[model samples]
Target: MSITVQDMRKGPEGYAWSRFGLPEYTDWMDESLSWKQTCYIGDWSFLWQHRFTGPDALQLISDYTVNNFETFEIGQSKHAIHTNKDGKVIHEGVLTKFGEEDYMVHGRGGYWLSFNLDRGNYNAKVSQEDWFMFQVSGPNAIKVLQALTDSEKLLEAKYMHAVPVTIAGHDVYALRQGMSGEVGFELQGPKEFSEEVYQAVLDAGKPHGIRKMGGRIAMINHLEASYPTIATDYIPAIFDADMADYMDFFLSSMPSFAQPAYIAGSFDGQEPSDYYRSPIELGWAKVVTTQRRGYLGADALAAEKARPHRVLRTLVWHADDVADIQNSLLREGEHYDFMEMPRDQRGYMWADRVEINGQLVGTTTSRGYSYFFRKMLSLATVDVDHAEIGTEVTVVWGAPGHRQKSVRAMVQSAPYKQDRSRGDLHQSTAP
Candidate 1:
């Protein structure tokens, strides 16, 4: 039997975080609020890192990604996306340029890049690196970092740009990139200085009300901000027969926690390939550049962009209908799949089928409850015609072959929370 992704679902189950450093430092509800009201410090050292160095490093990156790197400057970072020949994203991550020839990638994209580097005739050499990455985000995030370093220099680090700063006398780079869709800075440095840098931020953040964010509610931020993550929103496009060799290498080299990916909920894709999504479908068309060609999936992306069938949007589930499903658990013989609070505790995508007039028109993924908004929101890729704001749809709740319920929903613009990732730091002050 072929080793499918479903076959790799080994135990260590409930929210599988044996490798994730911190599951919860405080209550998840309070931590979730920190990024919106106060501030939060999240440890992202679990993200895999890769270093590429050579004269041809830039060429290698430009040839593979959909991004145009002609203006990518040193000390700047990009949400780099790697796609297959079909324009479906394989892996995406934060790629930063430290020097003209020095590049670092933090995420699964490194594996794909390194694999290609070995196969292609390029002078660039790839090696893994050990680094510590922590993100401080919220309206009050600037105050915490300002207290630790030169406020002027800290403010100089524009969004997606990195600036060198010292914390507790330890040299580190502060990158202004908010994953929580708020004013935030990512503190990155060598592994040795991780403890001191983290402690310094904790101490500095005390007065400003910084909470140590946990893994449980971390993805709630992604849902609110419309950041589509791999395995959660769309499966990687590397499981086909042609990519079997690469998949083998990936499974052998990666940790077990990073390997397994299984599908659930009501979006019944016939095959694994049906779950693959292009950049255009995922609301990342802005990131795809076509000024020049030769990149993987360049032609496919151009065609798809011109006549996109579906677009990503946010869905506001009807409160009463959601309550009806939950109420079923109390007074029914066969009840719907129990909905987890905040978000699904399991790491599966938990995708649900979306429809209009009883016709399947889209799919919903990344469902979560935002205490800040007091509403249930989810990301959906619906037909372009029905994707307009206020379009009414039905989200089929529960997995296939189970008692399901039709929950009414409305199509809304993505990033349900107003985006403040690029808020001016000078004006942002802690209360």
Candidate 2:
């Protein structure tokens, strides 16, 4: 069942109230700082999850996703990518392996998997499960986990590994992962313990300046940390004919899934595939294995890999030009697109056109003001030629049909934040 306690109906401005009760908790400033100096906790129960269990579960997932499951083991998780036969990414998410035939996936990745299982003669049974996930992250996140967990093993869990932790007299699974590119644990379990665990964690985190992070400020990590999101960057694979029934079920299940994408980019292509992105284009190049025998889209991905295309990078907006847009609100005239702090609540893709030398080159998405960095940053996918460090590009800001102002930007390497996610908590168990 969906978390419908609060009226989730989108506000006039395209904002939805998160399960956190309020839209904005504390302020964007303190919440933004919580991910750096202190810690922040946010509820991510909104994400859809599907559990697969059966004799053919592994094989069913192997044929649907791009992850190499030959070496997959219990307690291990991977950022699995699902793609069409043409190698275009359909959806991607975190896939966790529990038993040999048991798996849990978080995100829209289940769409492709469900589509395949329904059409194919697989013995796997797919059951959707609701989980209340709380993302507790920052430099001091482990501090709270240390106090709650009885086992030192939970505190020392490896990256992407899930360990059981006792919090508020309940055993919840804490996945050692990072959304802010820092030391963090995503504590998730039954919804009954959600309220109890949430309070326990908040009380435990009080000394560390633990702040309640709302949905608005929670997305800023993706900008600086370079985590590409669904709908915000690439369109899901719903246009294909085979997915007609799935779209019907998808839209009927969640009416908000029908949000349209706004494509305002310089890559003027006509086909639907033109709007699609490959696994490699989203900085997941390492996950695609050409050396392996075969998987869905493997051959096509290999072919696409042999060609030139756009890659993910960070674009730092010009200081004066960004200020000019903000200062416009003080004046009496129409202003450049208002850069909302932390995130943009608008539904559309909001992809801004990027150009160099008056020639269209790339597209930028996930535009936001990162208070952590004290600068306006956006994640962009530009042609490999324009992805060089310090390459200058101009971003066309504002909705279409409006006289847009040029915001100068420079290309920088993604993962602008120093990665502390894989750091060791205690002494190594290695010999």
Candidate 3:
């Protein structure tokens, strides 16, 4: 009854969830370079999608989310987060407005739509649907996409935008969003056409040097891109009553083999406290605008605008120090401290409580190897003082063994990788 990649698809290449799909090499730099030098196709159909329609759909959404959707144009997408009364994140997703009364929301978690429906104050209806989503990335991604679609206007589509186009004679939704920290596109289409679209990209990319990438390489890219993932890189928001029920369902439904997976945060089967975050802590303050009228969690978020507790910062671990710890265990018969990767194909790690000088200063969430930066990096929520760049601190890694070791780590900017790709996407010249 648990969720498995096989539950999503099957093949000799297996599903993108296959551990074998990851690069055979361990170094992320080489793997990422393979994509940058050529191209990489990723299977992203695991993301959940929901469709909303009806006369009251706009009103229903406008009143519940922090972002203003009143002026959203058709064929455009906007990112928004739904929070509980206490301002804890419920779900984050891209809102795609197809028309005045039709829209689709895509996100990692599935319960947000259900929670909105359960509230019963809105007149619109929500229903979940199955769709296959794929991400084509690297230098030549746009070329491959352009070959498949006949729409000449696609070349003009800007970043963070979406356009309806025909691909291989099938209608597909192509978004200019990418998680690989590269110039790319996300192609969403019907579940039945999943393999066709996947093959089309592979075929068109053959001349351009496209390789299939797995979750391991994708984790490195996410780290470099500074994109945060729920249930792996951050604590799951457990503030709302219906959201609590959804979390229970997710945990209970997980397959027996996946039981050891880490579930973030302390829900404890009760309403969450004020210790949770507003949009600011999640590094999403840009989307929070108070210029418009009232919305859900607006007042609370407005109050937090004046006084924000913790800011999101990046931690870069010294390569020599990390290597020494590992070598100590292998060469000197000493056990090295274990640091968890952000998204392990087998399972995930819980957020580690961080302390500095005997004071509870922060919590370290997303941690991964940055092949491009050639160092280990992590995303943390820390107090104002500890959040400053160049601040040094100690982080406790690994589960409690016979002996637990704390390693020295330093705070840096959130995005360890320079966002050259984002800039390149907007440039007139080809990447």
Candidate 4:
């Protein structure tokens, strides 16, 4: 494994190591809670970075992804998804426009860039960079950022917006985005400057009670926010055979972690299943625009719109029932049926096979405890009838011995959090 200097810098500070260099610092949940109840700093450096630039950059990006890049003003950002020819999601990330032709894509998967390069019609330059991402979140996050730079403008930057600033004499990109469902900002800068930037934020935030958080706390907040991550729920589409040979070659040249795997594809020797999802099924319909000319997967997605098969909905598992399953297994002296914490398998979990009442309908992607709401929540793709709010349904929990066990789950709105921090940060009303 190739470890960058950035890895050494963050390891002592408590970050997890995956196949990729620096995973999120989930090991530091205790420290996060102690400090986040007041203030906390988290390492988010593992997020991959892809830069697209050239005369036709915007046009190429607009044609490649589902979101309308034409609508995004310079210095603004939007969440977007890239679907396959079959209309299944390959990658999802935040697209930030830095200049007329400059854009950065931040997410776990990098095969999307290779897919664009292989399409090869547009004259655009694409490259990947090594950068470290750190986020300071909590009630005191703004105060910490305000003291780091002379740019008073950073203090007023709206949520989901970004501004270039200098921190501890190093150039840093700061975005007012929070995964914790709390008021916060994320800092991205050169890997060489990781320690300095982290120290600067800590120093500035100490007076306001800042504490360093680990990956566990960050994952807890991610569950609360219901944020979708690539490779965790859905695999990128480059692994599909429909792509040209050159595209496959380009993907092979990428780093191991960056390469697309056949986790959810039929090439893995598993039968094709409904674990795949279109952008519309993932609550990203707003980003799909047919008003513009055709883009990748446009035809397939259009057909899907005319005859949609399933819709996305949130599931609230019965607390008592879930607890009872755990208790029963303990009484039988058998291992627990499902993992107590959240898990991300590389392949998609087949939704239809894991249904209740012998009717295969939807697949569940993310499941976790909503600490803020005091309930267990899951994100699932279900048929229209069961997609309504307050609908009762059953979800197969996990495998019986080597297989997943089934459990009863209830249907609810897409977002289980009554008070979404993303919306809370933008509203005129105070929390």
Ranking by lDDT: 1, 2, 3, 4
lDDT by residue (tens digit), candidate 1, 83-128: 9999998888999999999999999888888888988999999999
Clashing pairs in 2: none
- For residues 1-431, what per-residue lDDT tens digits would candidate 4 score against the true structure? 22322332233233223322234443444443533365678887877788888898777777677776556787787786777667778778788888988988887334565566656788888788878888877766666777788546665677678888999899888887867666777898779989999999888987877877644445455545556555434444544456555345555655544433323111122322233568877767777876654677888887777677777777888887778756766675554454554333322331323265867667776566655556777777788766777777877654323434456788887655443335443231123
Q: Model 1 segments beyond 4 Å from truth?
A: 1-21, 256-260
Q: Poorest 10 consecutive residues of model 1 by lDDT?
A: 10-19
Using TM-score as the measure, the top candidate is 1
Runs with alpha carbons beyond 4 Å of true place in candidate 3: 1-29, 108-110, 239-277, 331-334, 337-343, 424-431
lDDT, candidate 2, at 28: 78
- Candidate 4 global TM-score: 0.81
Question: Per-prediction TM-score, please?
Answer: 0.95, 0.90, 0.83, 0.81
Model 1 CA lDDT for position 386: 93
Q: List the residue pairs that clash in candidate 3.
A: 2-254, 2-255
Model 2 bad stretches (over 4 Å): 1-22, 260-274, 306-308, 427-431
Number of the candidate with higher TM-score, 1 or 3: 1
Candidate 3 lDDT over 249-355, as tens digits, reads 55553443432123332211112232345677867777876766466678777777668888888888767767765666667555755443434453342355567
lDDT, model 1, position 156: 71
- Deviation of model 4 at 371, angstroms: 3.4
Tell me which of candidates 2 and 3 scores higher on lDDT: 2
lDDT of 1 at 421: 92
Cα miss at 197, model 1 (Å)?
1.0
